[model samples]
Target: MKMLVNVILPIEPFNSMVRDGSVGEIIGRVIDDIKPESIYFSEQDGSRGAVMVVEVPDASAIPSIAEPWFLNFEAHCEFRIAMTPDDLKRANLSKLAEKWNGVHA
Candidate 1:
């Protein structure tokens, strides 16, 4: 499965790392470890953040994939299954809609 890992780092440690010039080295090491399919860095909700897409063989691998960011940057991390356009096209939307479209109402 492919997962999107969203990382948001707090300003304090993040600024410190930037000032010390360790930010790139830290992020680089994790990138080397994960070898993500895609990665993007940008601001999110007024915080420094990154979004990376990587393959996860199983649930247990989440810790290995996430721990580096947490340890290095004191980051708030979130992981979610990500879908490509082809995957979305293959979904059984009609059935899902029937199942839940009006259930809340």
Candidate 2:
């Protein structure tokens, strides 16, 4: 599965916690702390806030894992299931749409 969690962390919190940390350190900590099956930090282009990609084996526990950054507005996540092209080609419209959207973005 693939989850695109877009967080607009308050400036103060970002400064205090994650902004200065090395990518490896932060990714490692997030993995160890949240224990998601796989999580990756993505650097946004010309954007104020950061974005993250998390892959978890199960769909549960996402709320708790995402709770910390729900400070400004709400933490927005676009969740999706991953599949090979052949699999995607055979998917229903709703599923294919999500995958297409991810690719285009």
Clashes of each: 0, 0
**Best candidate, TM-score-wise?**
1
Model 2 residue 25 CA deviation in Å: 6.9
CA-lDDT, candidates in order: 0.91, 0.54
CA deviation > 4 Å runs, candidate 1? 95-105
- TM-score, candidate 1, is 0.84
lDDT of 1 by residue, 1-105 (tens): 899999998897989988999888988999999899999999999999999999999999999988998888889999999988989878978889998887874
Sliding window of 10 residues with minimal summed lDDT for model 1: 96-105
Model 2 misplaced stretches (Cα beyond 4 Å): 16-28, 35-48, 71-84, 92-105
lDDT of 2 by residue, 33-53 (tens): 665544444444433344556
Candidate 1, position 73, lDDT: 85
TM-score of each: 0.84, 0.44
